[model samples]
Target: MISPEERNRTGRGCLLGNWVEERATTSLDKTGPESDIHKKGHQGILTVDWSSKLEDTSTQKSAFTSSKGTSAQQKGFRYELMKEHLIKSISEQVHAELTAKPAAAELHSVTRRDYTAGGFQWVRPTPSTDRDYKTDQAITFWRENFDKIQGVTAVRNRDAPFKKNASFTCPITECLDPNPENDLDTEEK
Candidate 1:
């Protein structure tokens, strides 16, 4: 049986995975509700544990800085901390995806900040923004390597009616046209 911590971790990982999937699937819908949902996700509160951990680290760094640490040392410390978290999260996420069975999950720290200027907060990105950013980045990456994703074609068909041509007529107008013969004997009394 998975422990509570493991469950929490996995739940977090699954949440991220689901978010990524949503972003990928809704990549083409710019004006859709998914984008709004994604924006909300980014602005939502940071996880409590991650926030506490960041606070503790910031306090330690501040104490160390005040105690004989030079400016360069402070800069180095911040850089290392940010790098460590990024590296750690990326690696762990990959490992979890690979080794854990499809049923299993893990927590991923989507945000990271250094211990400086009131510290940084890890904010969970929304599916929409993540998708948008991913789409933009993917386009750039693919453009650089045109050979890849070149054959990938997407066809979008608009469901809403738009004026196709100047001669185009409105269905509503046709229905409401006041001609006794236009009813073709189908009009109800």
Candidate 2:
């Protein structure tokens, strides 16, 4: 009594449900192909063609071999088919298992502003001179004042405050002190 559209939808839904069920129940082994085939309730046999589903036919054939030389072709066919079926079923199970779990918590940005300055600095010592006395004295002066020059350079290269924390008040409103004066301890008069 169902309309054609309704029947089609129901059929598709049933097919999907059966496919999922088959993927879940199928054993991950190539021992037998007949065991992998499922019979849907009153909806005909669902014969999974594992060999045809494989992307590379030659690879599949080369990966498996049969002991029976005379009937090798037939045995190889069944073996490849069963192997593909087992691989597909196992992959589906793993995919389902991975997707079922809750997603990992998102990482929050931990970036903070560098308030204090005066970090370590490295400077290449100026090349010394062997020819002139005045030039050698100038090089010696440069070598002696290198640390002071480096310190000055460090002060000049201080990192600018992050835009989010540029204000005098605390960036986090909840953690802000009600009386800002209490933050700095005063000597008892």
Candidate 1 regions exceeding 4 Å error are: 1-75, 103-189
The segments of candidate 2 whose C-alpha lies over 4 angstroms from its true place after superposition are 1-75, 103-189
lDDT of 1 by residue, 97-123 (tens): 889767555554444233344555869
Look at candidate 1 and tell me the lDDT of residue 5. Answer: 48
lDDT of 2 by residue, 71-185 (tens): 4465567899999999999999999998897889876555323443468466898758445654333335545554456423211111211113323453668545576554333
Query: Which clashing pairs does model 2 show?
Result: none
Native-to-model Cα distance after best TM-score fit, residue 32 in candidate 1, in Å: 91
Clashes of 2: 0
Among all windows of 10 consecutive residues in model 1, the one with the lowest summed lDDT is 154-163
Model 1 Cα shift for residue 19 (angstroms): 83
